[model samples]
Target: MSEHRILKLFFFACLGVFVLHFTMTLLHNTPEKYLTPRMESYSHLWCYPTFHQGWALFAPEPQSKHKRMEMRYYGPSGWSEWYRAEHICMDQHIRYRVTHYSKLCHVTQNTVYHLWMAVDHFDQQDRPAEQFYPQNMGYGIAMVLAENYAHHFLPEMEVHTLQIRLILEDPFELQDPEVIHFPTKTLMDGPE
Candidate 1:
């Protein structure tokens, strides 16, 4: 075969591989445990770059309320007063620390939301939160928050125990806000 023909054949072969990889990725629904190591690696290499995983950025789920993080640290006597992990900026100056922490909370919240959706879809048919959500999800986010809390706020305070509360607020309602507390042991245990 001529050199030009050989090059054309090679190009077509590469194109074919790319198409196959992309198609498999787009349609991939198999759980990781079933995939061989090589197959898993191949999927990671090809699929991750091509796919942008997330819900619609412009249109999110309907939110009647907003949630914020509140934390209390271990103190000499007992737990310190609960304070907002997120900063409240009254000044005009941009608070980058606040912005960064807020973004972390946002990401963690979204991660938990996605995990909840998956659990809801699969296992919640018969039994709901009692069966699966707590055991399977939110540990990663909890660890991230705990470590960040220690590193950022209570480095000198020797924070042995941390309690984080998710405070949900409704703008329209005058009623008391809802507060959900994460387990202190889970926060201290670090990521699994």
Candidate 2:
């Protein structure tokens, strides 16, 4: 074949591969179960960490609610009083530091929420618990908070364990709304 014809053939082959790869990625990401086990395995092995199963962030009917995280640490003396992780926006007089801390709180909340959604998805799919728990963002946030409390809040004390409680409340409820708590435990000794 002529050199021009050979380059044209190579270009077409590349285009075909790209189209096929895109199609496979779409199929892997879709919620519908259509791919065979072998294809699924291939997709998981190759496309993982890039394409994930679909998940909804919120329901069609959004709830008017507020959420916050409170944490307590086990120190040398005993368990310290619960400290609320206040978002910067919640403060009456917001300084630069307050705004920075508030942004951190927002990021932590978002990460935790995403982790919860992932856990829910895995549970619905009946996947093994070991697949997604240890590396989750919720556990990560707990560890970071424990370390911060030990180093900054009480430098003299060493934090052994942490209890992180996520409180959720619906403001629009007519009756008194009991805050929903998702309590999580974390060992401070774990890898940072």
Candidate 3:
């Protein structure tokens, strides 16, 4: 093939890959209910984290409430003072401005968000919120993350158990801040 023809073929190939990738990405980001089974299976296998995309930037229902996470650890000396995860994570981000700092923020925020959603789902189903813990992915991950955060920040203290609290502050609504207290999770066997 001539040099120009080779270059033209390469450009077309690149464009085809780009279009195919994004089309799959778009399909993947869509809700499973809206996608056919074949498409859903294709997207699930192909578009996990590596090719996945988030739609938070174009959020149709923007989050108006500011969520905060706090935790207290129970040890030999009794419960420690409540430590704010947001403050610690934000401080790290402000000082370092690195991916890890931002990820810390995600970990804290995701725990609160997922737990809140889990509780809401249980409520909607007319099930006791307490019952959700056994099968709740959010509860499982939260326990692990909460324990990790406790260890990271309070290395000297032996944390026997910890409880996480989620505070929802809506400045836009001017409503009283709502607080949800999660059950105290034992760290005896480590995270569930």
State each model's C-alpha RMSD to the native. Answer: 16.6, 16.9, 14.0
lDDT of 1 by residue, 1-192 (tens): 999999999999999998987766854546877888787667665654445322334446545556666667674456768766444221211456545555655655664454334434644465444344345445345545555766665667655566666677764345689776555543343331
Q: Tens digit of lDDT per residue, candidate 2, span 97-178?
A: 5445566556656755754564456557654545554465665655575456457546676677666665655533344544
Q: TM-score of every model?
A: 0.45, 0.46, 0.60
- Which is better, 1 or 3, measured by lDDT? 3
The 10 consecutive residues of candidate 2 with the worst lDDT sum are: 49-58
lDDT of each: 0.57, 0.58, 0.76
The sequence of per-residue lDDT tens digits that candidate 3 reaches over residues 78-116 is 888888877877887888885588888877888778877
- C-alpha-based local distance difference test score of model 1: 0.57
CA displacement after TM-score superposition, residue 68 of candidate 3 (Å): 2.0
By summed lDDT, which 10 consecutive residues of candidate 1 come out lowest? Answer: 85-94
lDDT of 3 at 168: 86
Please report the TM-score between candidate 1 and the true structure: 0.45
Of candidates 3 and 2, the better by TM-score: 3
User: What is the lDDT for 92 in model 2?
Assistant: 21
